[model samples]
Target: MKLCTLVNKDCSKAAVLFNSKKRILEYISELAHQQLPDVSKHVILDALMTREKLGSTGIGKGIAIPHGRLQGIEQILAMVLVSEQPIAFEAIDKQPVDIFVAFIVPEGNNEEHLKTLAAIAEKLQDKSFCKQLRHAKTDQELYAVIQGDDNG
Candidate 1:
């Protein structure tokens, strides 16, 4: 599973100005609704919030990956967002998060979902790559950074 396979140029956002996790999730919900209109925004938010209750998706290093499973979806959907300022995310490292990658996957596809999560994690582990992502000035630049050759 590749980041480009799940996220497109249009799904990438740069310099998102949200102050809280709830607000970020709201934006993510809106993106999910745009991609999966048949799935209710409430359902998307509920699933993501429920997952968060179990543990924070903020994996540290100024990054967070919030993901959820939905029943009606046939395939995985993803969105990438970069904040203008870091937001407190209750991450394990106790650092604020500035980069967010949200995932919505079809229910019962645990194998693929985990693979995708691992892939994203691996890609984000590169400090230089993350720096480029943070420096991206526009959505197109952000998308290019995410879809760059280093992702593999």
Candidate 2:
């Protein structure tokens, strides 16, 4: 249930230009499509959007964890995106968000989903870790920061 284990270099991006939450979700859907070609990007977007509709995933402090549960997925899919600038996300704290960690999980495994989300949330809660993420210059650096590589 580690965030680093859930996210890989290819699935992660740094300093992306996402002006809106919709664009961020679309990018995440594309990433998911790349990993799971059989699953439609539209379906992926729908799942993520549905959760957003219930409430903003924006956990404040410039972070958002947009997640969804879907059938036909054997394992969890995660993608990370750091925006070039903060974007309005309607966060509960009423602050803008820049860091996005999106997840697509198997619909039946609620326990796994919660544990994975908790792990991700815990990691992001670290101010120093988030500072490293925001300072990452490239995808590799971003992935490294997620992996806690200080030199990255």
Candidate 3:
């Protein structure tokens, strides 16, 4: 359950501009749709929104892991975005979010889903890693950071 396995250069973004959490979610949905053409964008958005209502995915310290389970997905898919500015996400710490590590997992696979979520959370807990992700200037740089290569 490595971030590198779930995310790639195409799914990673840098310096994205969005005004609110909803807008950021929309962007994530769009990226998910592109990666998974078989799944509709609306379905992805609906699933994510439903999960958000249950609890804010915004973990804290300018980081968020918005995730949801969806039908028709065989495995976990991920997208990462670094916002140009922090946006309110109703996180536990009541802090704004600037880094989004979103995931779409197959429905009913609770075990793998939780495992992957925990793995991503563990990686994001590192303040320096989050800082490097925020400062990434390009999609390639962002992917490099996620792969634990700060030299990029």
> Which has the greatest TM-score?
1
- Which candidate, 1 or 3, would have the higher TM-score against the true structure? 1
49: Cα error in model 2, Å: 0.6
Which one wins on lDDT? 1
**C-alpha lDDT (0 to 100) for residue 21 of candidate 3:** 89
| Candidate 3 lDDT for residue 34 | 95
RMSD for all candidates, in order, please.
Answer: 1.0, 2.2, 2.1
Across 33-144, the per-residue lDDT of candidate 2 in tens digits comes to 8998999999999999999999999999999999988899899999889998999999989999999989999999988889888878888888888888899989999988
Q: Pick the winner on lDDT between candidates 1 and 2.
A: 1
**What C-alpha lDDT, on a 0 to 100 scale, does residue 94 get in candidate 2?**
92
Question: How many clashes would you count in candidate 2?
Answer: 0
Cα-based lDDT at residue 6, candidate 2: 78
How far off is model 2, as Cα RMSD? 2.2
- In the range 105-134, model 1's lDDT, one tens digit per residue, is 899999989988998899889899789889
Judged by lDDT against the true structure, how good is candidate 3? 0.89
Clashes of each: 0, 0, 0
Give per-model TM-scores: 0.96, 0.95, 0.95
TM-score of 1: 0.96
Worst 10 residues of 2 by lDDT: 143-152
Which candidate model has the greater TM-score, 1 or 2? 1
Give the least accurate 10-residue stretch of model 3, judged by summed lDDT: 143-152
